[model samples]
Target: MTLFDSERPYKYIMDTSSILSQKPGETHTRLVYKSQWERIEEYMRSHSIVTCSEIFEEIKDKEIKEWIFSQQCTVLEIDDDIQNNVRKIVTENPKMIEFTGKSGTSSGDAFLIATAMKYGLIIITEENKDKQMKIPQISKKYGITSVNITSLCEMEQWKF
Candidate 1:
């Protein structure tokens, strides 16, 4: 119930890859994403794992979807500020064009980066930093910190 506490140090926002990769029945030692279902929920709630509606819709796992919806994780809407940031990021990175949908519509990278930048959230995306116009690379230009799922676990100190 305390997903957006101003008292928290930072908000951890996750992308679709984080959901698709880290699901139940996975295994890991240092990272917690591949841990038990209950532990993952506990970790998300305690750490304030926030995400956007676009990213949430990308998740296909029933259990994960249900858990996220019912948990304290904050799912933010795409507001004006986020949309404006997305335009800036997308305009600067033309390479992201190829990553867009078939109709060359909205891209998750833009949304994720914008959300993180506008709200000062720590983005969690599996996209590689070196990839052309990826979240990690674009985040650098916007001065926003973006990390992969494993890196997120390290930052949160989630160990078995």
Candidate 2:
């Protein structure tokens, strides 16, 4: 069975950055405002889409991790297929050169995008750069739609 077979076909994919925003932390403060948290909860509960464990590690907030587990969010498993796809993206995407610079995009981000593409999922991220420097750009290149937390809330009609 597909992940969203019972519900609407899963259209939304969340990056660690987007999911991690709901958790309290220094970066979390800047990631998303307090008003968005409620909507995030509502959306997750209603939609059944969520970030993977790699995303959890990037979050760096214990409370958020606990909350994620408590919510029973589906944890994506990284297998050979996902790893191969990530490698393919890294090798093929020229923009990745400029985007990551010396450090390069993390394996987690690549895996997230690859998994989304493989499953035909829409990515949700906060990075606003127009180019393919972030997941949004990569998603765009792969023809996967992407949006921010606030936009998602609006789409879902999630009210505080």
Candidate 3:
């Protein structure tokens, strides 16, 4: 089954980095910050936005982690196809994921890309385009579209 509505103009899958971009500050968290977070949360709740379930492991901030869980967004599970694609991506580009000094768990970069490939979804990420290992670059190699949150908003003509 498709994760997106066939009638919708655009369908997007978010990477952990892009999701965390809306996170509030540690000190002096203002109302506007909370409002922005809530707005994104509301959008996710109503939209066909999806994200890899593995992102839960990558999230370290308690508030951001909680926000992710609280949202009603669809969390894509890792299937054999996604796993195999992830293997191919990781084997070909080791720098795409940083596993050094960490446990068995790694970043959700590969999973995000694989999911986007599997479902024909455009990736929403915060990684810069200048970086070779970033999602935008790696996704391009696989013929997948990747855009930042700001671009997504502009494309959708969202005011907030």
Question: Against the true structure, what is each candidate's TM-score?
Answer: 0.76, 0.74, 0.80
lDDT, model 1, position 128: 76
The global C-alpha lDDT for each of the candidates, from Candidate 1 onward, is: 0.71, 0.68, 0.75
lDDT of 2 by residue, 25-80 (tens): 63446345666665555556665576655666666667867877776666677777
Ranking the candidates on TM-score from highest down gives: 3, 1, 2
RMSD (Å) of each candidate, 1 decimal: 4.6, 3.9, 3.8
Q: Kindly report which residue pairs in candidate 1 clash with one another.
A: none
Error of 1 at 71 (Å): 2.3
| lDDT per residue (tens digit) for residues 30-132 in model 3 | 3455654565666677656777788756778897777767887777789999999999999999877776875433568888888888878899887787778
Query: For residue 159, what is the lDDT in candidate 2?
Result: 73
TM-score, cand. 1 vs. native: 0.76
Q: Which ranking of candidates, highest lDDT first?
A: 3, 1, 2
Which ranges of candidate 1 are over 4 A from the true structure?
1-10, 24-40, 99-106
For model 3, the stretches where C-alpha displacement exceeds 4 angstroms are: 1-10, 25-39, 102-106
